[model samples]
Target chain A: MTLEASFGTSKIGADNIGVNCGTMLYNEVKQFRINHSIAEGKIKMENQVTLKLNYPLNEYVAQNELKLQFSEGTTLGDLFLKEGIPSDSVGFAVLNDTMLHLNYRLQNGDFIRVFPLVNGG
Target chain B: MKWYYGKLLRVNLAEKSYTVDEIPEELFTNYLGGRGLGSYLLLEHVQADIDPLSEENKVIFTNGFTTGTSMFGSSRYAVFSKSPQTGLFGEATSGGKVAPALHSTGYDAIILEGASAAPVYLEINDREVIFHSAEHLWGKETYETEDTVLREVNTPKAQAVVIGPAGENLVSFACIENNYWHSAGRSGIGAVLGSKKVKALVFYGESKTSVVNPELLQELMKEMAATGKDHAGVKAYRRLGTTQMVAAMNAAKAFPNRYWRDAYYSHWEKISGETLLENFEVKPTACPKCFISCSKKTTVKTGRHKGLTIEGPEYETIFVFGGLCLIPELDEIIYLNDLCDRLGMDTITAGNLIGLVMEAGQLGRIPVKLEYGDVEGAAQLLRDIADRRGVGQVLARGIKEAAKEWGLEDLAIHVKGMEPAGYDPRPLKGMGLAYATSSRGACHLRASFYKPELSGMIDRKTTQGKAEMLIDWENRLTIFNTGTLCQFFRDLLEWPNVERLVYAITGLEYHKDKLSEIANQIVTNTRIFNAREGATKQEDTLPPRFFKEPVNNGQDRITVEELQFMVDEYYKLRGWDDSGYPVHEEG
Candidate 1:
C-alpha cells in the first residue's frame, strides 16, 4: 500500500498505506502489469490501469471506460490533473470496489471509478 | 396582489357547495405561500386531533408566491393535510403544469372540507367551480382518470390532479397524480383526498398573474437559466436525472441496500443511470416554464415490460424498488414504478413496506412468503395493497402500523410513520438528524444535507458543525418551499437573486435579514403545529437499526447517544428548548 516516489521504475514491493491486501491482492495481480521499454527512453507503462467514469464524470472523460497509463507513484490527484478533470469536481473515488482517498497511489492493473460532486435524494 | 391572487376556493363536499374567500394579506406576508400558507391554513381550519380520514379533516392545495410567473423553476405546488398514515402534519410538493394551472384559476389555494356523499370531481374555470360526478372514474387508474377528466372537460389544455384506486381504497401512502405522471406523493395526502370522495381537481384557465417588474423578472430568469446551464450539478441532473446518484451513492457508501441492511448493492450497475441511458430510450422532460429539464421520460423497448412509458423511476424510486428490494433488473424496477404511479401510491413508502414484509417473513415474524428480489411478487403486492385485498389490507396501513400489528415494530425502517428516502444515515450523519427532525416524517428534500456531506464540502463523519449547517439548510429550503420554487434551482438562486425575485414579483423589496426572519418564522410555526399535534423530542429519532447495526461491514456507525447530541444542538440552533419545542417571545 506504500506509494513510491521514484519515476519510471516499478516500485511495487511494500504495503506502506495499510491497504487490505489480502482480498485486493488477487485483483491487483491479475490487473497489474509492467512494460519495461528501457530502450525507449525509460517510458515506464508499469502503472497502466483502467478508469471508469460515471455520469457527469463521463461527460468530462468523453467515454465510460478508459485505459490510461500513470507514472509509478501517481495518485488520483495526479491522474485527474493529467486527464483534465478538476480535482474539486470529483466527489468520491472507488478503486477495485474499495473506496479510496484522492492521495491514494495508483497501482498497475487497478480499476478506478470517479464520481462527480453531485447528490440527490 | 401582483404575485398572489389573494383568494382561495373553498369547496364543501358534504353540502356540495363552493365559495370564494379572500385570503388575509397579513397571512401572505408572514407565511408567503405554498407549504407555508397551506400549513397555516390547515392548522387553523382542521382540528388538531381529528382523524385524518374523517369528514372533519381539511385538505388544502396551495400555489407558491412565484407560481405561474415567468420565474425560473416556479412550477411547483404544495398539498397540505393531516396524514392518514402518520397522524401528523402531511405536506407534499410536486412540479408540473398543474401548479400553473391551479394558479391561473385565480386562486392562491383550494380548500376541500367535509366528505361527499358520493365520488365527485371539481372543475375550476377561472372563478367558477363546477362539481362533476366521478362515479365512472372512481375505480380507474390515474392515467385513465386523467384522460377521462380531460375528455369530459373537452379542453386539451386542461390539467387534472387525480387519484387512482390506491387513493379510493384509502391506502395510507396513496399519492395525488398529475398529468398521469408527476405526484405529490408522500404522507398519504391522496388518502385524505380519497376520504373527501374527490377524484380529481381539473383546471382549464388562461388567466395570468401580473408581476411588479416584468422586464426585470424576465431578465433575472434568463440569467438564472444561464447560471444553471454552467452548473455541474444541473448538468448531471439534466443528463441522467436523479438516477445519476446510484453509482456515486454506492461509491460513497450512502446508498441504502437490501432494506437498509447493507450500505452497498453489489449489482448496482444494473440499475444505475448509465444502464438506463444504455438500455432504454430516455427523453428529457421539463416542467412548465423550466429551462433546466431534469426529469426523464423513458420507454422500455426491448424487455418483458416493453412499450412501457414512464415519467421517471427517479433516484428514490430506483433505490426503493431496486436496491432496497435487491432486484437487479431495471425493467422490473421500471414496471414497478409505473404500477405505483398508476395506482397513485408513493413508491418510496410502498417499496419500503415490501422490503419490510420480506425481512419480517425471513425473520419468522410473519407467515408471508415474500423474499428478497421477488419482483413479480412485489408488483402483485402493490396492486393488492392499492385494492386493499387480503394481505394488502394489512399493508395499506403503512409499515409502522402494519409492523406493530404483526408485532415487528423494531424491524420497520421509518421515522414518524414515514419511510426514509434512499440515503443511509449511518454514513451521512447529518441526514440522520434531517430525517429525525423533518416536518413530515422521513424525507430528504426537507433539508438535503447530503448534497454538502457527500460532496466533500462538509465532513460527513463528524457531528461537529452539523447543527449550524442543518439549520441554515433548513431555513434556505423552507424559503424555497414557500417561494414555491423547485429545489433543483436552489444552487442557481443565491440569496441576492432571491431578494430580487421577491421584489420583481410582489414589489415587496425584502432585505436579506427580512427573508431570513420570514423563513425562521415559517419553520417555528410548523414546529408549533407539530407540537400541538403531540410531537415531542422523544419522537425525533432514527430507527433502532441505525444505532445497533453498522454499514459497510462496521466501517460506518452512529450511536444513539451521538444522534441525541446532534438533535439537542439542532434544537438550540433553531431557538427551541432542549425538549425540541419552539420557544416563543412573551409580549
Candidate 2:
C-alpha cells in the first residue's frame, strides 16, 4: 500500500497522506470503509503525499507529474480526508475533466480536482 | 429623498383602511432603516403581555435606506413583532426584490394592525393601495397564491409574502413565504397573519430609489463586486450553496445528529452536499442584485416523492429533516422541504416539532408510533399537523405545548418555547449559549458561528471570549439589516463600505464613531422594546437537555456546567446582570 499528496507550494511525502477527519466524518467514513471492504485491496499509504491548490478551479497534476504513484484505487472523499479537508467541503470532484463521485476509485495516471461549496449566489 | 421614500404604509385590517404616513426625519437619523425602523415603531406601539397572535399584535415590514437603490445586495427587508414562538421581540428577514419595491412605492415600511373580518389580500402600486377578495386564493399554497396574484395583476415579475395551509391552521411555526421561495421563517408570524384573516400582500413600483452621491455609490458597488470574489465562505456558498455547511459542520462535530443525542451521523456522505449534487437536481437562484445566489432550485427525481419542487432544502432543513431525524435520504428531505413550502410552514419549527415527536415516541409517552428516518410517516404527520387533524392538532401547538400534552414536557428541546436551529449546541458549546440568549430565542441566524467554527472568522472552540464575538456579530448584523443589505454583502461591503454606502445614499455624513452610536442606539431601542414586553434575563437560558444531560461520543463530551459558564460570560459581555437582559444605565 502506497499514497502521495500535495497542497499549495509545499510537498510532504510520496508514501503517505495526512487527513484530520473530524469526529462526525471519521465515524461515517470509518463505518463506510468497513462495510464496503474497499480497504482489502493494495491501496494503503506508507508516507504523506502533497496536493497543490490555487485560486478558483485548478487540479493538482502536471503531464510529467502523473507517474508520481500513491493514487491507486482511492476515492475523492478518501483523498480529501487524507488531506484533512472535510468531505462536505468538496462540493464537486473531477478526474481528467469528468465529474467523479466521492466513491470514485482513482487510477495511477488520473489527475484529481476538488471544489468546495464556498458561498451561495 | 434619495434612497428613502421616508414614509410608512399603515393598514388597519379591522377597518379595512390604509394610508400613507410620513416618517419623522429624526427617526430615520437615529434608527436608520429596516430593522431600525421596526424597533422604533414597535417601541412606540406594541404593548407587553398581549397575545402574540391577537389583533392587538402589529406586524411591521421595513426596508433599509439603501433598499431601492443600485447598491449590490441591498435588497433585504425585516419583519418585526412579538414572536408567537419565543414570546419576545422577534425579527425575521428575507432577501428578494420586494424591499426595493416597497421603497419605490413611496414607503420605507408597511405596518399592518388589527385582524381582518375575512380573508383578504393587499396590493400596493406606487400611490394606489387596494384590498382585494382572497377567498378564492385562501386555500392555495404559497407559490400558487403568488402565481395567482401575479396573473391577476398581470405583472410577470412581482413579489409577494403569502401563507399556506399551515398558517390557515394556526401552526405556530408557519412562515410568511416571500418571493415564492424566500421566507421570514422564524417566530410563527404566519400564524399572526392568519389570525388577521390576511392571505397575502403584493407590491409593485417602477420608480428608482435615488442616490445622493452617485459617484460614491458607484465606487462602493464596484468595490463590493470585486472584493466579494475573495471571500471563501461567499465562494463556497456560491458553488455548493448552504448544503456545503453539512459536510463542514459534520467534520467539525457541530452538526446535530439523532435529535441531539449525537454530534455525528454515520451516513453523512450519503447526505453531504457533494452527494446531493450527484443525486439531486441543483439549479441556481438569486435575490435582487445579489451575486451570491445560495438558493438551490431542487427537483426530486425518484422514489414516491418524485417531481417535488422547492427552492432550497438548505443546510438547516437538510440537517433538521435529514440528519437530525436520522433520515439520510436526500430526496426525502427535498420532498419534506416541498411539503413545508406548500404548507407555508417553517422548516426549523417543523423539524423541531418532528424531533420532539421522535423523542416522545422513543420514550413511549405517546401511543401513536413514530421513529427517526420514517420519512413517509413524518410527511403524513406533517399533513395532519398542518391541517390540525388528530395528532396534528397537538403537534401544531408547538414543541412546548405538545410536550406538555403528552405528559413528557422534559422531552421537548426548546428555549423559551423556541426550538433550536440546525446546529447541535451540545457539541458546539458557544452556539448553545448563543441560541439560549438570542434576542428572538433559539435562532442561529441571529449570529451563526460556522464562520468562526470552520473558516476562522473567529475561534471555534474558544468560549473564553465567544460572548464578545457573539455581541459583535449581532450588533454588526443589526447594522447590516438596518442598512437593508443582504448578509452575503458582508463578503464585499465590510464596515467601511457600510458607512460609505449609507452616506452616499442618505447625504448624511457621519463619522465612523457616529455609525457605531447609531448601531448601538438600534440595539438599545430593540432591547427596550423587549423589556416593555416583559422579557427579562431569566428568559435567556438553554433547554433542559443541554444543561441536564451529557451528550457523549468517542471524544469531547459536553455537559450542562460548561454551557452554564459560557452563558454567564455571555451575559456579562452583553451588559446584562447574570440573566442576559439589556442593562440600562441611568443618565
Candidate 3:
C-alpha cells in the first residue's frame, strides 16, 4: 500500500474508482484532487493520506475530508490524535475494505472511512 | 397509579362491541407494561393449545408509561399473540408515530378477541370504540388502506394501523403496517388480525400519561439533551441509519452472502449504506417526538425504476435481499422493500422464504426455476408468495411448510420455523445461542448479541461466559421493550437514566437487580407459555447447517458442542433444568 496516486483532476465519488490514477478512490469524495486542490488554492497540505470524516467529525475538521501527511510507521491513533479526534468518539474505521482498529498502522495512499457508532439491526 | 389510566380496552369482533375494564394495579405492579403486561394478559385470556389463527387467539397491543410522554424513543409499540409463523409465543415491536396516538386513546393496553363475520376496522377515540365495515378495504395494500382510513375517520391527528393483501391471504409472515411504512414487523401479527377479519385500527386522542415527578423528568431531560447533542451514536444514526451495518458487517467478513454460500458479497459496495446515499435520493426520516432520524426515505432517481420510493431497506432487509438472495443493486432491493411494505409482509421472512426458493431452484429441487440475483424472478416469487399461488401458497404457510414441501429441510436455515436476521449465527457463536433459545423462533432482537460480537465486546468464537453476557443483554433489552422505547436509544439510555426515568414516570425506581429480576420473570413467563405448547430442548437448538458449514471458508463456524455449552449455561443461569424449562416458574 505505497503511495501511487498522481496529481490529476478527476473527482471520485460513490463506489466509482478515480480515473486519474489506477488505484486511488475516495468514494463520496467531492473534490479530492490532492495537488489540483492545492494548485487552485483550495487547501495546503503535504500529506498523501486522505481521511473522509463522516458527520460530527466533519464539523470538528470544518469540512468533509482532511489530507494529512503522516510520519512513516504512524498508526491510526497517531493520525487521529494529530487531527484532534477523540478515539472514544469513533465507532469504527475502515481502511479500504477491511475493518481496522485504531492501533493499525497507516499505509501510504490509504483512503480511510471513519464513522460514529450506529445502532445496526 | 397517577401516571397510568390503569385501563384495558377489550374489543369483541364477533359481537362488534367493546368494553373498558379496570386493570388491576397489582398486574401493572408486577409485569410493568408492554411485553410483560401483554404476555400475562395473553396467557390469561387464550388457551396455549389453540391455533394461532383461530378466533380464540388474542392480539394484545401495549405501550409503556413512557409512551406519550417526553421520552426520546417513546413512540414505539409492542404486539403480543400466539405466532401463526412459529406456533409459539409471538411478539413483535416497532418504532413509529403510532404508539403515542394509541397511548393517547386512554388505555395502557387493548385486546382484540374473537373473529368478525366479515372484514371490519375499528375507530378508537377517547373512551369510545366504533366498529366500521372494512369490506372495501379488505384487499388494499397497507399504505392505501391507512391513507383511506385516516381520511375516512377524518379526525384530527388520527393514526391508523392497517394490513394489506398478504395479511388478508393469511400469509404466515404478514406484518401489521404502522406510520404507513414501519411495521410491528415480525411474528405474523398481521395474520392474527386478518384471521379476526380486522383490516385496520384507528387511534386518536389528546389524553396524556401524567408524570409522577415532572420536575425530575425535566432535570433528566436537560442533562440528556446536553450530553446527547454531541453523542457519536446520534451523529451516526442521523447520518447513515442502520444501513451502516452493511459496511461494518461486510468489512468484518461477518456478513451472510448468497444464502450463506459465501460470507461476504463481491458486490457489497453497490448496496452498502454509503453507496445507497451516494446513488439514491435519500432523505432522513424520523418518527414523532424523536431527534435521531435514522430511517432513510430513499427514492430511485436515475434508473428505470426511477421515482420509486420507500422509507427503508434497513440493514435486515438489505442483508436478506441483497446479501442472501444476491440482489446486487440497492435500488432493486429498495423496490422489493417497497413491495413488501405495500403488501404488509415482514421483509426479513419474505426475503428469507424467497432466498430458500432461489436455493431450491438453483439445486433443481423445485419445479420453479429462479436464480440468485434474478431480481425480476425474485419479485415474481414475492408476489406469488403474497398472493398464495402455487409455490407461494406453500410458502404462505411459512418456512416450515415450504421447506418440507420442497424437500430442502436440510438447506433451510431457521429455528422453530422462523428465519434469522442478517447475521450468520454459525460464525458468531454467541448468536448461535441467541437464535436457538430466543423463545420466538431465531430472533436477533431478543438480545441483538451480534452487536457485541461484531463490535468486539466479546470473543466472537468463544462460548465461555457468553451465556452470562447474553442474558445480561437480553434482560436489559426486555426492559427496553417494557419501556416501549426504540432500540436505537440503547446507547444513550443507560441504566442510571433508566432508573431516573422509571422513577419519574412510575414513581418507582428500578435498580439493575430489580430490573433483571423483572426481565427474567417476563421471559420465563413466555417460556412457560411455549412449554405449555410443547416446546422442548429440541426446539431450542440451531439449524443443522450451522454445525456443519463454515462461513467464508473460514474456521469461524459453530459446533453443536459450543452451542449446547452456551444453551446449558444460559438455562442453568436462568434457573432452568437441563431440559431448557423453568424449574419453579408458574404459567
Residue runs of model 2 more than 4 Å from their true location after superposition:
A1-121, B510-513, B552-554, B557-561, B577-579, B583-587
Error of model 3, residue B457, in angstroms: 2.0
lDDT of 3 at B199: 97
Flag regions of model 3 displaced more than 4 Å: A1-79, A93-115, B584-587
lDDT values, one for every candidate: 0.84, 0.71, 0.83
DockQ of all candidate complexes: 0.34, 0.11, 0.33
True contacts kept of each: 0.51, 0.15, 0.56
Query: Candidate 3, residues B419-448: lDDT per residue as tens digits?
Result: 998887866788889999998898989988
Interface RMSD of 3: 2.5
**Candidate 1 residue-wise lDDT, B424-529, digit = tens:** 9999999999999887899899878887787656678889988888877777778788878898877777688888887888788887778878887777777777
Q: Report the C-alpha displacement of residue B336, candidate 1, in angstroms.
A: 1.1
Task: Identify the runs in model 1 with alpha carbons over 4 angstroms from their true place.
Answer: A1-51, A65-82, A94-112, B583-587
- The TM-score between candidate 2 and the true structure equals 0.83
